[model samples]
Target: MKSIVAGLATEHAENGIGPVVLMLHGWGDSLHSFDALVQKLPGFRIVRLDMPGFGNTELPKDTWTVEQYAKFVAEFCKKTGVQPEYVIGHSFGGRVIIKAVSQRFLEPKKIVFIASAGVADRQNVHNMAFTAGAKIGKALLKPFPKSLYLRLRKELYRVTGGDYISAGALQETFLAVIKEDLSSDAAHIDRPALLVWGEDDIVTPVEEGKKIHRLIKGSELKVLSGAGHFVHQQKADEVAKLIQEFFI
Candidate 1:
């Protein structure tokens, strides 16, 4: 375990492996989310980035979009010499990985998206309009505007479903990721892939996973029964097992 200005990172390595696996966490989550899986995978070196603004890394003033986050990961990989042979992205991280792969930032042997986003078919449960309302409500709450502020706050929650982004830094600290279709770019990757989905996933439903499987030619898809958006978290060992087999 070591510390960098960005955040704390822990590295684990297999006895003998030529490749590395880099883990990216879902939005509002930290690297520790995959701690158990990391310990279990002793055959391949694993590195998890505690993405800036979450986990050990302090939040930055520059609001991070998926592309910006991907670039950060790409640069981190370059500086660390940890050329990922495999990448496993959860939710928002999945979007970042797509950007990296599409832009040729990192050429991993295989990539995994665990209930990812960035696809048009994904039924976004989190309506982003609420995010803007929340910011507005918070900003308008200064001078005894209680009634108006409360009205806006309720409206925002009804839309975003909850406070995913705090109001303070506009597009600098936190911003909703613009939805971009990646079906074509993902198909072009041509790398081996594993798409794990939970049948009960509300965030990115199983249908989206199936569509992804179809788009990324020759990719494999696995659906877990009774699992939600966090399928890997619920069944970490099983997910790790599948990944281990694919990596080997």
Candidate 2:
């Protein structure tokens, strides 16, 4: 289904016929990222959307922070009349959920975060260094041909594990989102929460999950073996089973 939320054209999907389970995908992913996981989750109303700047959803004209994304989710739910009983977020989507629920944007009975990002620790420091290096590299390459400069810049981002090259027009927004840590937000969560992490998740990593788990008192953390960043997709059955058990 398509709807206009926060003045942005949004693409979303609704399936099944039970309690609403809103699933938020990670950065660089669409609602389709949960295709396998959704299928495994039966007997629940599943809601997933192409968040602003991703999938078919129109990107915001101005750069947006995680708080803005949380507000957009609240507005989208209001516009769609969706009162999620259980909310699930993966990666970047998890960051939005944490900000939203902590701020009372959307109140779900229980929340689940899968390989969520938002904690700014040692990894963030490395990212800051990478950003600095990129800026210096850009200045040094200004005299080279535009094509060569662009190619080298892309390689630099790849080598440094930066997502800026893939952010496309939302590069500024990406910078804003990653720089803000959500540890305080997680600390404020009083609702029941479940965190799922991939044992081999180098993106957000297992340590980040452990940090969030500690922030949200009583929150349970489950680390799946042999899974990486896209644990929900890679281990759909295991993830779905965990969600089912947690929501129950």
Candidate 3:
């Protein structure tokens, strides 16, 4: 139940292995989200953490940017004496890791992003609509929550993944990630990277995975059939198998 105070992370770690593997959960998810993967990975020491305002972890007293969060994660790594040789991040956590890598934080020997979100390209008309909705959402909030906001996110949760996330945290994450354009920075990622996605992913989309593969030379992309936005959860064994294949 111990955690690093990034105002963003609460961690779970098991020591005694060759190197540490820090697992970062997505928004609305706790360290337990990575439970399946950790169980599959008996070869290395594993650490999973709850992100801010998502699970047991509290959001920072001050509103922090993704870059700041990246610094926090890096600082957390430094303090733990873990020296992770590999790192894994899911969804929103994917963005955070990229931000950290861009700033040259905890450079790992290998990195994996499951349904990542660094691509700036939009797929079609529907994506444009989502962008519009996000823009409108940022303008008003804090106390007066409209029905539209709740419905929109609940629908996204239902459609994208099965997790029922808090509207407030979802709104905050949406606002934080929408304006981000990681294309320029992604080109700089030189680590051995793996990008995986569910063919049915609605959140980050398979296109996002494709874009990551394209941007990061030599990176590999694997699209699992019949999987959706919460592919990591829905298809944990498959995802974990790939991670094992990549990490080993």
Candidate 4:
């Protein structure tokens, strides 16, 4: 389904017929990324959307921070008349959930974070080093031809595993989003929370999940064996079962 929410054209999907469970996908991913997991979660009314700047949804005119994304989620729910009893977020989506719930944007009874990313302190150190290196490289190549300079900059980002190169138009927004550390926000979440992480996840890592688990009082953490990031997709059956059990 498509609707105008907060003045942006939004694309979303809804399936099943039970308690509403809104699923938020990660950066660089659309609502379709949750396809496999959604199929297995037949007991609940599953709603997933292509957030602003991703999938078929229209991107915001200005770069957005995580707070903007959280606000958008609240607007989306109001526009769609969806009152999610449970919310599930994967990766970057988890970051938004933390902010939204902490700020009372959406009062879901429970939350599920799957391999989420918001622990920016550890990630910031590496990002800072990369930023310094990029600045130096750009200065050294300043006198070079424009095309060559741009190509080299892209290469530098690729070599350093920077998501910025892949961000395309959302590059500024990506930078703004990652700089925020959500530990304080996570601490404010008083809702019952379930954190499911991939044992071998390197993107967000299990350690980040552990930190969030500690921050959110009464939250439970479950690490799946032989799974990496995207554990919900990689181990759909297992993840679906867990969600069903948790929501019971």
Which predicted model would earn the best TM-score? Answer: 4
- On the 0 to 100 scale, the lDDT of residue 98 in model 4 is 92
Please provide, for model 2 over 160-216, each residue's C-alpha lDDT reduced to its tens digit, 9 standing for 90 to 100.
755788899998898788778898999999999999999999898899999999899
List candidate 2 stretches off by more than 4 Å.
143-145
Q: Which regions of candidate 4 deviate over 4 angstroms?
A: 135-140
TM-score of each: 0.81, 0.94, 0.80, 0.95
lDDT of 3: 0.74
Question: Which of candidates 2 and 3 is the stronger one according to TM-score?
Answer: 2
Candidate 1 TM-score versus the reference: 0.81
Candidate 4 local lDDT, 72-188, one digit each (tens): 999999999999999999999999999999999999999999999997567678766666666788798889899998988888888875678888899889878887888899999
Each model's lDDT: 0.72, 0.92, 0.74, 0.91
**Number of the top lDDT candidate:** 2
Off by over 4 Å in 3: 4-11, 123-173
Ten contiguous residues with the weakest lDDT in model 3: 160-169
Candidates by lDDT, descending order? 2, 4, 3, 1
Say which prediction, candidate 1 or candidate 4, comes out ahead on lDDT: 4
**Candidate 1 — worst ten consecutive residues by lDDT sum?**
7-16
Q: lDDT per residue, candidate 3, 2-33, as tens digits? A: 66575444655564465689888776667787
Tens-digit lDDT track of model 1 for 1-248: 33443343433222235468888987677787787777677767777877776666655545566677777788788767778889999887887888889888888988998888767463333334444555676676646567876676566554564324343333333445644566676776678889988889988788888888887888899999978999887888888888888777
